[model samples]
Target: MLLYIHIPFCDSKCHYCSFNSYVDLFHLRESYMKALSVQLAYELKRFKATPGSIETVFIGGGTPSTVRPELYRPLFETLRPFIKTGAEISSEANPNSATSSWLEGMFALGVNRISFGVQSFNNEKLKKLGRAHNADDAAAAVLRAEQAGFKHLSLDLIYGVENDTKVLLAHDIEEAFKLPIDHLSAYALTIEEGTPFASIPDVANEKLALTEWFLKRIKKRFATYEISNFGDYRSKHNLGYWEHKDYIGLGSGAVGFLKDTRLYPTIDVQAYINDPLSIQSELLSEASIKTEKIFLGLRSIVGVDEQILSEKEQNRASLLVKEKKLIYENGRYYNNDYLLSDELALFIEQ
Candidate 1:
């Protein structure tokens, strides 16, 4: 089993972000962590989590670094008995908020990995993205994490924004390689509804050729595990999601999955604090579950199991295999090129 904890607090909201995070809710940090502990207790019973059953833990957010480590200690203490030995514990951080003391504190609490949201190494691009940290601050924060004894470090980079040239992207990749990070996530800019960027959708400006070129540059140093993710050390928590493992999502704005049911707690921080056990559940049909597996499998190294396909879908998959679009081995079909994963899944389903 895997676990995810959400921290919906940020110092500032990015122009292009639509995640359920708030900048004004900083006052509720303490109350929110307390609420999270309440939810954790309920979910432990609901998910039937056994001792040493949790394989990985990921703390994502509005910005996880905004909260002090002491605020997180209660949750870790409760989870310690259920976490497997040498489990991967990761947290998402921002360069501006992830101070030296913060990094040391989290490391001392058994968080061995840090995934920094260092979207770019160019100051101009950073401003365009409304990022809180400049290029230098990002570099310094990452070095601090390494100095604090983090064994695995990862950072994110964004591409396909307006005025993204090969020279600019190449420089970004070069700067990232200089860091001691083993994992990198390169995402193309996409306009999401209800975001500041939504008013000016053209700011995204993705060019297919440029995106492919940028990915190739990063792939030179790290291996691509998914279309947007590359790393020498793949994240077990990330792979767990693609593999459809059962996970308990703690906190507001978080989603949890078990068997065929999806669980959601409230998105409002205040409401969640009042009653953390007030969760909504959705059931997934078998057909929908199978479809999800196919799409997820084709997008990463986790290939689709042959037994999950119908006879008609199997025939279509065989055709793709014959045409060199997929590789069939060990009773599973693997995608050779992640770019065509969606199209391939659609063809098989159709």
Candidate 2:
């Protein structure tokens, strides 16, 4: 099972972010760690996770790098018995806070992979996005991670903003290749319902053709494993989710899946710190799981199994295959183009 730990702290809030992070609650770091450990230990026992059973551990958040590495030592000790040997343990970091010392310290604590939040390479674009780190900080962070002996490094790049030009994104992509990275997550900017960008004028989804061009160029060196992610090394933690594997979440604003139920911990940072064990859950219905399986399968390398769909849906899928929108082979149907995954799913389901 995959394990995800959310660290809800950031040095500064980004304009486009809606994550449950806090910049003003710096004083709560130490207490938060204690609370988190308490919660994680309880979860491990409740879930009955045996030693060397967890396949992956992904620590994500507002900026996991903001907290001192030593703060995580106790939690590591608690999880050590349960973590599988040579398992992929990764954490999300911000370029500004992910110093060389921090990277080395975390690595020593058993985190082998670091996914840096370097959203863009252009200084102006970084400013527009209200990112704390400059372009140079991002490049320097990657080099620092390399020098620190980290084998797996990934970076995130945001494209498809309002009034953005292809030349701008193309430059970002080119600069990305200049760094030593095994994985890349290219996300199209989306204006969420409550983010600052949502009120901005002209916010829209990226053009399909331009996105395809970026994916095509990236495929030259990296494998297009997911719709928004590409890499020589696929993320085991993310793949587990797409393939409907069980996972446990260990903090505020984190989601955990256990069989047919979805667990949602408190979103308020302070509240979660106060009562880490408290959680709200939703028991998933078969229809909900089936719909999710179809949608997730069509969106990534995981394809929908032929037997999962009804006979009518299967026949519709076959028609789509003939229309060249899907590829059916070995009792599974895959989306020919990820951009049309939703449309194809809707058509087949109808």
Candidate 3:
């Protein structure tokens, strides 16, 4: 089983972020951590699963580094009883707050992987994105993590910004390769409704060429295991989700999935703190799970199983294979085009 814990506090809010995170919620950090520990203990016992059985644990959110690492000590001690050998524990941190001490403390507490939110290397671009970290801060923080003995370091990059040029994209990729990084996630800027960038026109479609170009360059070093994620090291936490593995989601704003049920904890920060186990759950039908498998598989390296699709769907997929749009090998159908995968999956399913 996979595990996800959300730390919903941020030092500052990014303009385009829509995640369930809060700014200026520092006063509640200690209390939230305490509440989270209680909920985790309860969930583990209720689920009838040992912590050691959990393969991956991803601690994500507003900015996990913003919280004091020492506050996490108690939770680690609680988890030690069930944490198995060779488990991959990951945490997300913004470059601005991922200090040397913070990185060290987390490492000492069992966090082996670090995913840094370094959207861009350009200071002006970072300012526009409302990121608190400067370019130098990003570089310095990463080196510090490396120095702290983290072997699994991944960097996130946002491409397809308004009027983003080829030179700009190349420079970002070039700068990224200079760091001691193993994984990279390149995503197009999305104007989610209610975000600061929502009023802006979507330029992702217009920037496909640049995206393709950047991929061509970056792929020389990193493998394209997924549509957006690439690297020498693949994130087990991420791959587990796409594979539809059973997982436990702890903390407010976190989601978990079992055989048929999807659990969501309270999104209201104060309410979640008051009652961290107050989770709302949704039931997933067999058809829903089947559809999700197709969608997620075609979008990543996880190709869909042959028997999962109906005869008609298989025929359509076979036709696409004949046309070289899909590749069928090793008893499964795989997507050849990330951009066209969604449309292709729909057509085959239909």
Clashing pairs in 3: 52-82
* Cα lDDT of model 3 by residue, 1-350, tens digit: 88898999999988889998889888999999999998888888766776478888899998999998899998888887676789899999999899899999999999999999999998888988889998899989889999999999999999878767888778888889999999999888887778777776553344667878877788898998878899999999889998889888888889989889999989988898899879898999999999999999998889899899989989998999999999999989999778787998898888
- Note each model's CA RMSD in angstroms: 0.6, 1.3, 1.4
| TM-score, one value per model | 0.99, 0.97, 0.97
**Candidate 1 overall Cα lDDT vs. reference?**
0.95
Model 2, residue 94: distance off in Å is 0.6
Which runs of model 2 end up more than 4 angstroms from their true locations?
203-205
lDDT of 3: 0.88
Q: What is the lDDT, from 0 to 100, of the residue 135 in candidate 3?
A: 85
Candidate order by lDDT, highest to lowest? Answer: 1, 2, 3
Estimate the overall C-alpha local distance difference test score of candidate 2.
Answer: 0.89
lDDT of 2 by residue, 106-203 (tens): 99999999999998988888887889999899999999998888999999998776656778877888888899999999888877767777788356
lDDT of 1 by residue, 1-350 (tens): 99999999999899999998999998999999999999999999998999999999999999999999999999999999999999999999999999999999999999999999999999999999999999999999999999999989999999989988999999899999999999999989999999989999989998988888888888888999887899999999999999999999999999999999999999989999999999999999999999999999999999999999999999999999999999999999999889899999999999
Candidate 2, residue 2: Cα displacement in angstroms equals 0.4
Off by over 4 Å in 3: 202-206
